[model samples]
Target: MSLLFVLAFLVGPPAVLLTVIGPPIRGWPTTDQLRAWLQQPLTEETLTAGLAIGAWLIWLLVAYTVAVRIIIRLRATTAWLRRMPLPTPLQATASGMAGAAVFGITTNTVTTTPPEPPQPVATGTAAFHDETAPKDHRDPAAREDGVTVAGGWLPWEVAEQVTAAAALVWLRRRRDYQPHPTHPDDTDLTPLPPTVTAVQAALADAPTTPPSDRTAALLEALPIGGLGLTGPGALSVGRGLLVTAVLAGQRHSPTTLIVTRATLVLLLGPAGETLGRRLPLTIVDTVDEAAQPLQPAGPAAEEFSPGQRPDEPSSGPNHQTIVLLNEHDGDEEQLTRLAATGTATAALVVVLGERPDGPNWHANSTGHLHDPHHPNMPTPRLCVLDQTAATDLLTVIASPDPAPPGLASERPPLPNAGPPKLSLPRQVARREPPHLSTPPRQRLHLRVLGDPQLLIDGEPLTIRRSAGLQVLVYLAIHPNGADTAQLTDAIWPGLPRHSLTGRLYTALSELRSTIRTASDLPVVNHSDDRYRLNPAHIDVDLWQLHATIHQAAANLTHTTTAWQAVLNAYTADLATTRTWPWLDPHREATRRRIIDLCAALAEKEPDPHRALQLLQDGIRIDPYNAELHRQVSWASTELQPWDRLTNNHG
Candidate 1:
């Protein structure tokens, strides 16, 4: 395509010239005659030839103008395509299914029963809400099977991304605001596992709005894990399919998968035994065991009963209980009875082969499912994971759950310190104060607490390539550096590793060159196959915020000033508008810390008006925090009756 443009640009003018001044075989002027006509002064023949030449020149100009316009349009389209995440239906479904799985595991509402509203704490400082906590916009949708986002079907990937992102946020909030007791003994110091972090990075730019009804329906209709497979290698493929479904189903809810022992080994190989024990899955011996009343798998799951959450109808899709049975194990009579019982209990019965009483979709080795009754219909492809992929996924699911960033000090009120004191402790010492007043003019400025921007000596330096900016952001997040594999996986998730090596190098080179040209410093340092930003040469705002937070913790004598410094340092949410796939967890973690900071500071403030203002600021940051709202109410009550009414109404 570019060659065609070059040909048109370079060849068109010469062709026109040859046509205008070639030998007179076709009534065209000879070169000598054209020269004579140009040399002549104001003759009619000269004017006619000149006009003819001028017309050709004008034609060439018009062609070039149209070509330029077309080039611009093509470039614009190419950039748009690069920015658009979902380009295929299969990828969309993968994202949605993965998102749903993430949602299931990370949802905050995880209890056997609907919890009552939170009452005030005994100390009267601030009462944290339990299950009755004011829900965020996406919390309800996250609990359901389908997550809806605003807009048409075109942005359904955004819907899925939003679901995954909301789950992550809820998970973090739960860890921060409402720690669950289900895994009381489970403790891992790391903020999040690699799989969860990758998923968070994959869906970082999801819209803040909750999914819309139309979008939710569209997502629900996605044929993620098809009903059943019965082709040549149907059982093998079906195992992967069923396993995928189980993973997705049990993630956020207390869902269970009941499979026979033989079928479990066939599905997950030797790992099945370990998985069955670890996951909320039950491996049964025969059809008789399958028919027995099943237990709730996880903390949120409840036994399928008559009365639980009376407001919610029994028919509603509250939770899932899937039963996987082999054709050989169950007789026709038992299978029929089990199918009926499954329907009554809102359970799904999946058979290994074509069952007369079950949903039997045939699948080929390629993972596309076909309805035997309607062969002419379009085949929906199932999300089939091979042994390796499925095992890896299960391993991630089995990994230790996360603990919130700062779990040790998660109380609502600030610690009991009388006031800022003048004396400094023997062990405590203060470093030089951070440059909080203004951004340093002479040094490199890397600001990612808002929109990512790199400024050299106070002047904006654009990193022309998106990948280049991504490299910078990745390095900013991991100051210690990242190897080639980590960088590729985080930046380009599912792309072939071999194919991305060159592109990765180019992005890195471009980043280094751009920074070097602007600042005359090697911003990116490569050592031992790992790439990181040169911390000595550059000053990142995120790092500054971290320092401020640490200082606040150490310097208790200057409590008020220190807390305010932390707030001021956090200019905005980390990388505000930019939605890099890997930024969501980091962003949410920082946001939660800030909210905690505000609440703690407000609790310590002695002045009623000042305390109210502090709590209000925290509310602005996180409006749905029921604890913050309750604190606001408590603070308002401390004022005089008239002031209280004015504050409440205002």
Candidate 2:
């Protein structure tokens, strides 16, 4: 207070002196004159000067306080960044320089042109002071085109550059850093192994808004569904095909989820990019839409354009799916209708919004969508054998056939197995041959020559007994199928009719259940006392082998690749643990045909060595078959005409 009083007295006197703009007084003023001046009302010049000085001082005090606070905060922020688990940004310098360069280029501030005389240099380079140039002198055309005025350096330009550099460093660190997976013990993520952990960390780093400056890690982590589910291998359709293959043993027509248009846009292009653009996703809106049957009137999936990124690849027509945007009502009648009828050809996948308002389509298991409203929900997103949650209820239906505590088999044991010792020979569970490289999504892949095995999605099934497996094989061979009596006679020829019926029923039931669990489809279908594999759900290698061999035999237009494919198909004989007696007859017939076909192929082949190779392959498949050995011997004995002629000349 004392210092301020002294300073105020000195400052006021000087300021008052300056306002009395006149010749300096030669002598001290008289006491009476000074008293008279003080007594009179203060002049406007003196009052104005006093107010200006006081205002300036107040502003100085406020500015100093703010600067102190800012410095304190900056130090704290630096410490926080240093302690973060992610790196503190090696790319900050490069990023800042790039950004500044872009800004300068856009504003016409970065140039080689020299500034006016008395030019000051920054960093030893001639500094270009753009402010001196008149607004009209700068490219008037470009200025009109929304180019912001870059009139040299602003008071805080340097500070702004420093702050921006800091921000960019933090952003890069966050984008690239993968948080340790919190829910490592999640059951759904178990099958994914290391891929699950990686994908989870990526999802954590990807901000829901997906800023333009997001690092490469975030961009790579973005889901393919964001590319608008077009072309071959679109995640929605690919997963749908995988589902179809699992359920029906075929990836024919895909299943599609009619997404509301607003939600659909988030998965695609730049709605998220445009600042201040809020997607119209709300709980109330969804509830209102899901209540009624969706007519899907807004726009077909055609409204969706290809991905905006130049590097993103365009997919094919097969990947083009029509999901109706903004079409559902609160009751979720669209999904309910789809689930009830099962008539819709394509499966539905909810890509962008909250789960359907109603309970009809509740089982979702699929990918990470950038939901704008709940940008930072901290929960572990999970998928079964994949990266995202599945939206299909049918997917959950694939849950392992209900295992109860100390569970017993539903059907009784096969009647023929002798007593307590030979009762349940539990070796029928089939696992895929380690050699075949098929993905889990492919249903019903078979490998039978060395060890007869049935694989559903690369996982093998084991039938409890050889007889039950034989029944499945027999049914596979004859598509038209067999009557109960025929199957009974085939399995138990001398047994009584009643006993055969009991045993057959038990075996058939167990086999059906096994196929259902493995392929998610019924392999054996019984109708009007006749049994056969459900035509739509079976893919036997034996069938392929027969077709390929026949194709080779009918070489009306022959090609080397085709013959090679034929020989490849016939490389192995049928069934290793020959349980079914019925297969032997057909197996023999097929082997003879393949041997004859191979011999014919060899006869037609131009190269004697290739022909010998084919003959050798044929012998290897059926070594003991006299005809195959005989054909091999004949092929070996027969010599080319050139060799015969050379011998005669000798």
Candidate 3:
């Protein structure tokens, strides 16, 4: 009701008042009156009475009602157009205009007519069949001559309507029509593959409704791997179209984009700068360069390189959302992981030109530009983008801020081809380029004995962050994963949740990455709260050491070899760094287990010399333990007789 009042009072009056005010100024309607209703020559009294605010307002209300009815009629006409067969372009246009005009003139254009009386049946129809009447009565020529009606050309509307009705009846009869199946040998019957651009264009211009410019909503509503952009990277026009689509998508967000193709980033960097946007893009130009960040960097560099580019300055921007722009060799696995991880972390991927073996929004100029390796596959959701869209996207890439920096555009690395695919069992097998492909996942070797050390393929692996290693160690100790809150408390205590959350992800990524480098298997997995190490491929020495001790203790008849294995498993005190008070319980438990094993072995051994040796070793580990000291004294006493007898014999 309130909206009605606003529109009725505010909107209606201005348009109506223009008529009364316009005549005296520029002079329209030529005759000083609005219609033929004026009684005498135009005068102030007459004009004032006719143009009274209430009277004019009433007229406007009537016009509004008429307009509503006209709109309904127009909608009906549009419906009719959809069902009707195509007419000549000239006739179609003319009919459309005429229909709309008639509909506007009055709302009651549609009417029902009474059925016409049935034509009289032929006289003596039974006699004619029995040959009782004239035989000519049965002939068609004779029956038509009885009326002798002269025919005339039908009106255009009647003719068109009859023809349309006939066509509709014919169409309905064949509504279930299907094309005949082709012969097996008929190669010509094979379907032609549709290009991505053609498919997308059809979608863009589909006539069900008007095209929407709600591009922002379209982007956010997309599911992971639900959208992609493909075009000839060689064509500048195609490049612009893709770049535009990406920037336009990010317009409503601050999400990271992990671009795998360098050519795309190269095109985007300058375009972004030109558009006044300064995107937070990280360039991993090569595979070797990509892993370098996973490995250790300088202390200062490592400190500042969490969830960001390492080369970035300390005070420079460290954005949460970044674009990974490059299709580096052997990045198929990395990109796949990135797509999933980024999505989990609120990052989005936009593929340019390259056809990733996944479903997404594909934008391409032609089908030929598609990846030859995936020749038979089709990109159903692909859309065609033109130069205009590209230009608009460039504008969108620029930052909304008024001021932009004066930095030179950074050129990105060109894409390098990996080893060719070889067909195996109807699937193309791809090989990664040597430098770009990270090692396949295998069993991990973790040493948490004295100082934490990581070994990959028997070589000392460099660690980038201590926190990540700590997370691994903590998870290793805890077979079941810990929640983020518990991990934060254990790994990065006393830190704010927001700050710690990002750091935790960064650390986790680094750890998982290094684990992949040394051992192809991911060492850790997290769902909601808990993050756990996979027991299958990860071998933690501390875990093994405990197992060894249990097996040795459980054996009823212990062998010297069993005791030796237990001792071998324990290289040093549990975890050398003793800064954490949390380690106290584990440290105490391990020490006590070793002492008990040594003492038990000493008492059970038959050799007095070996017994002395076991007791002394136990004493070395725990000199203050009274039982070990006593055992050592007893062993020495037992050996005294043997020493005296040996001297007497000599």
Candidate 4:
């Protein structure tokens, strides 16, 4: 509202007065009248009115600024309110109505004069009708056709109504359209296999014949209404279609749908039929039951029963089955214990709500007992099911199965094979390379033990462990050793003076062992108690990487060569997880070097495609880099012209 007031005072009033009163006042006394009016403007009444208008305009402008600041603060404080969920249509409608209301109110308050009708000129009249004609004016009908033939103030009310109505209609249409839902079934599922033939063959070999009317009876017994198919033949087709539809909806491969559907039908149909014929009515009822009672507990229960041993065969009815159900709570020890007791013949069911890393049943290859003491103990046949499927699967397992003629009279060999092997081709041995005969090169072998200690080459250098390594690395970095006392005090500030020498000896022993193992070079030598890493014997990749980076930095304008040099020097982060007091500064310096190289390449490379590729590779190493993104954006603009047209339009 204050903004409107400021606009009205500064612009609206001047425009209105000039159009409405200026022409009339100018004509009041012709030349003589204008001169008189200008002379009269020094009157007290005119000055008072002018001063009052200026003061009101100034106050309105200040008020507008204050109001804008208050609005910004209010938005900041209640920002979360914008994220609160609201019905889309209601939100759209409210927005539209608010905009219309604001436009209507503002337009009503602002007064605008109607433009005067254009005077038509007589083609050849002495009356000077041509002199009064509006410049670039056209007939009213032509203007009404939507062409702006003349310039003049447009009434605010008409413009407001037009804009508000258009906006309201657009909002209403947007609210009317429904957005499509993202169905989980629509996701790609093309990675499964089909086994229809296997299922049919299993069914055909069953010993007992199914009743002729069995399929019809089962269809009638189905809980769900209106299955279009009945009987064995119809049931097969219906099952196939149902499986296909489910798989298709899930976007799975057609082959996978066939295999999974066939498997399901074999399990639920022929397998169920064979079980039904053999089991007594009472046993069938028990098998179909939902939950089993937890086994009774006693002092003797802690020990395995004679037949309860995983390998022991039960002497009860051949069909009698034991179903073991275990839940994992993510304790590795508990999982190990459960796995140790399971046998191959025992049906082991594991119910897990979350993935247990490294120690879960899925991670076990043999599903064998986890203990060395029970190495020969048979492990259970493992079945993993989510919570919802556990009850049904458990019931099926408890059910008695009639020994179908082909119930594998003999158990098949286990499928738990050992590690996969590569097939190697026959080959002849070759002579050794020339470099193999040379004695091992003398180099520093740095060995880090437990915490802070470094062995330089093979000899135990007499220097503080922390200080010696720092001095060695610094020297390895600088190509020159530091003063002994200077290095000692740098690493061990405020140390007790007496024990410093003893501590330095221990540190030097560890450093010597480390350096000897790390390289075969006599890299470290003491000259007047000052230690240094022999630069020639050390094979540090850091030096090479840095040298290459320096070379690249020196030749930024010749980017092709510079980029190649940087690429050759690139390596995975140095001792990425290891931390040292001195390593951080070096790491940071290397990072800055790489960044500078990238900047130089970005500036010198004329081909945006090449630049974009370089930036992308850099991003892979440093994902959070902002400079890479900036370079990518610039390169994209350069590439945009190539994609301007499509062949289809032509």
Candidate 5:
């Protein structure tokens, strides 16, 4: 209503006055003649008559209505664009995908070292399938088409929608998509063997509704179309088309790309080393090795062909194989035979040189493809990946599978490890006061022990990006500071430093700007390429908790007071509800220490009731701890007799 009033005031008066002022200004009547006409009686012929006044009133209403509708239409379009799920180029890139990996979300094991003897810690596994269920955007069960195709060649709106829909579908399938289980603590970083589920996840989401018939045609032609490339950028162009086909393979019919290890590296750069293990790729050592049909091995082999004999031809209606070859290694006879087999089999085979009988596209050094055979046809833009783009995309594709439920099945034996010894430096412990000292209140307070939040004085400050908040949490854990590479590994694991330098820098810059804007103090300090929070300006609760624990360890005389302070400092588990891959170690370690502290305090308590309360606190954290349960039972027994005697006396 307020907006309408403002619009009316700006436009309504000017529009209404046009009727009274328009005709005379256009020379229908002179200024003197117009003034004289107003003095005339209410006659039908006069301009000042009642009929003329009524017509002008109707004109004002019509003009206002049109203006209001136009304004509304414009606003609606703006909002729609704002809400559109547009997948940026970054989203398809390696760093972008790394950020999307299911790190600690569902059920995953993380190794954390506590006090002296190492014990396997179980961070309670969440329900595996529940979190990965199909979101509201699209139904996962509606996978008639095998894999969604990457629609990078399509228009902006079309491409992003395709990407988002594909991601949702992949997530739905990922719940049941388990590759062979490998130990989480394995030292080897080599990519594992491929599985059917792995291939499906690597492929794009099948479109629920395509934007246009032309897009549909383009997508359809990608899997079966025998594409050949020639000229300066043939390898690059062919690589793009191959990646697109792999991403777009149908769920009912999957596509396997066969290429030599050398060619794969040339096509995708350094990322090729990891891509073969994640995507639907069968990488061989030589071009000769690529000529053979794919044989399923281990569990994947059984999943691929259950009843069929291994010696028989495994080709079925459900499989689509695309073999990528180099021109240098191919002969005329081999190329013709390969091309003929592809046509008969309803499969695709892409080459880096001109084929004898099919359409061969020419590529320029700038990574653009031109169809010389049919100049009139639209030259669909191929999905070209440079080194950085390849790394980012591979990282996204290589996102670790959601760990299965009931992880950490082999629990390490927990010996009666007495009270935890503080791992603080001797000099630092001596420098600390006997009692927990209160520092002057700082303007910025970063709390990460519970639900992570940053506040300026008392009011909560909002950080726009999740990465920005993550930086604060990571820095809070490492008070001394961390360099860029270390931060990237922690935040976006498996992404190369070169690919995500800008992303990391942007997060740091934005966080610094936000903090300075709120508190007018530069809380984040960067020098020698290391970033750290300025403790003088910003106060971290995690740091304070450690200090109190250290004070308790150093001064046994003030242990009772210090223990209480330690309890007060630890409000909850670190970054509760967050599932960063790097957070599990810190979160579990802190939780164990707190439980130990509770037990230590209870053992010393003289009053049975006080000891019972302390034991209850420990049980609240570790409900599965048998020792804590035993102590609680003993405390209850001690109190039972006293309560019965009092009742009888009353």
Candidate 6:
């Protein structure tokens, strides 16, 4: 359409000007004059010449028309013929012929025009329009005829070029403006692992609103949703606020809690206050207040009256001493001093920041805390805190009121004297389960592991640091472990075959060294040109999760306890850093398993409550799953109150 418009606009005027002015300007002899001149010559020769010219013109017209038809047919057939494999020679010939024909047709179409019929005129009078007279404005037919006659012989080359250019422009514009299909609300756009998607979905469906409105909507409606906001400070604050808000709203508390870092508190406090007022919520700034009570001061006398002391010495330690250390600052001295004081009835050590070096304290300690050599040994009460954590130790301390018998009071007074004697055996006397023997003193051991960009296992691992972690995760997922070639292909499918082995070796070596350093466990074993994680030494969540899932699957027909087992199995993304192409199938398989397990639980559970929970969980994990929606509808129907059910179904 555009091409035609451009050609008409540019070429039409030039052709008209040339046709109207050429004869008068050049004073060329008219066709009549030429004919008269020829007639005066030898009659037979002139007549033969005229007939030959006319015949050639007729032949040109016939050939041009035939070429145009052939070109049009070829254009229409090209799409259908493309599916068939043509011989090289034939293809080339066909292409050349089509091109030539198209060119010829275009050239002829632009150049050819019928000659005008002769008009009668008074003798010796100029055939010019009287401009001063009123024009025959109402006669459009006459006007069009006059315009066509005025146009001179249009050049074939120019007209063809203009037409081609316009067509090309039109095609480009059409392509640019092509409309993409609208995405359905049910489509999942998450590029991450299914586990991440599941977690996001679960959070979305929970009664509490998400931290951000945009994120909440995305989580509820879209397949995947998240914020790229980095930094421990922001995450801690955001998470705390979200959790608090959800909890508070569920409890229908008038008070609102804003848990955040000091810097954020400064920035967002006023905004929070304003929001609270508008929403009729109370906002409490918990950043600075959280750390105040956790900090240790000099020991002082017990504040409680003498009679308040537990009867019979409680047959155990009077109070549990928790040694809290900021690992990021390498400040273990404070923790050690607190542990040595012997004042704590039972010590609860909290390590903030990275894991400490080995021989870890638990390994070397002579007191009760010791490593049992089991992969799943009771991870100590050690709470590792990052600088950004919004956890108020005081709040955790205060949360469980009516403190356990002999446990320290929430407001225990600091001791008055210098640090107490550090007699190891004496400390054992005060420990609970009096028969418990003092084990070997272990160094303060903490394995700083997991993805740093994301908090896993209470510590963050940088992307560079997470590569080895990811490798361990991959091996853990593979029940039999992967061979060199398999591992190489999984990790680096795009690499050249020759380089795969080298890259695999490098990754394996680095991974082993990292795991050894982080866990102080001999996790990797090399034998028969393949590497595998030592199941006995490594405590892998993935292994436990898979086992639980399998166990649950076996008992599907019996009971709905399998639902809880399946939920417990899912903890975090399969692997954080490594993007192994081969793992996609495994990841997808696990996702389907989760979906199936949840669906089965929803269907089998006799209690509508359990069924509803299962259905909701399944929906959160697989929002796009048609089965999930069906299950939710069924569960909701079964669980609805009698009155609401009657109204709804009716």
Q: All predictions: root-mean-square deviation over Cα?
A: 21.4, 36.9, 35.7, 39.1, 23.0, 39.8
Off by over 4 Å in 6: 1-467, 518-520, 554-562, 576-580, 638-650
Q: Which tens-of-lDDT digit does each residue in 1-650 have in candidate 5?
A: 97797677666655656555443233366788667767864555564445555656676686788789889889967845743444435434644445444343334455553223233343221122222111212222322112222211222222333344334433333222211111112122222212212222222222333422222233333324355778877765565555554544432135566776766777767667676676666777654466567332233243334674322222444335677776655667767666656555544567778776555778775455676755665555454444444444444445355455764232321223234344441221112223436764447789998989998877889987667888999888888788998887666543345756888888878888887777677777899999988776777888888777666655444446766787789888899756454665566556556655665555545555666786787777656555566667767877799678878999
Higher-TM-score candidate of 2 and 4: 2
Off by over 4 Å in 5: 1-225, 241-253, 260-262, 265-280, 283-319, 365-367, 387-411, 417-443, 449-452, 462-474, 482-531, 544-650
Q: What TM-score quantifies how close candidate 6 is to the native fold?
A: 0.30
Of the two candidates 5 and 6, the one with more favorable lDDT, higher being better, is 5
Query: How would you encode candidate 2's per-residue C-alpha lDDT over 1-650 as one tens digit per residue?
Result: 96586567546655654566432334676898678768874878546656766755665576577669779889868845643332124344545656676666678854685332332222221121221112221111111111011111111111122223322322332222211111111121111212212222122212222121211112122221222222222333333322222222112133223344343333222331121022112122352343233333333333234543211222322222323332233335654443222112212223222224321111123323232333463221112222132221122323232335542222212222221111111112223434546653345755555467777767788876555766877665565778888877555432346646877777778777877666676667788889876545557776666666655656624636766787677656667445233444445545555555555556556666676786687666556544445555655666466478778999
TM-score of each: 0.52, 0.30, 0.31, 0.27, 0.44, 0.30
Question: Local distance difference test, per candidate?
Answer: 0.57, 0.41, 0.46, 0.36, 0.55, 0.37
Worst 10 residues of 5 by lDDT: 178-187
Best by TM-score: 1
lDDT of 4 by residue, 543-616 (tens): 56666665665564566777677776665554343333234334443444465456545544556566667667
Candidate 1 per-residue lDDT, tens place, 363-475, comes to 67645567766567556444444555455445545523455577543444433444322221122122333567786435787888778899887777887776777788777
Per-residue lDDT of candidate 6, residues 1-650 (tens digit): 86586557555544544464322134566999678877686577456556555654565566577669779888757834642333345446656766676666767766665344234332321122212111211121122111000111111121122222222322332222211111111112122322222222212212221122211111111001011112233323232223233323323332223222332333234343332333222232332232333334334223223553211112222221212223332335533343323222222222322223211223111111233333353322111122222122112111122325643212211112121111110110111222437852212111211231222244543324223444565666664666777665444332345645765566667755654455455656778867676655444555556566556645645446666776766744344332333443454444555655565444445566766777678667545555456556655665568447668889
Candidate 1 lDDT: 0.57
Which residue pairs come into collision in candidate 1? 104-251, 104-252, 105-251, 105-252, 148-211, 148-212, 149-211, 149-212, 201-581, 201-582
Best by lDDT: 1
Which TM-score value belongs to model 5? 0.44
Output the lDDT of residue 581, model 6: 33
TM-score of 4: 0.27
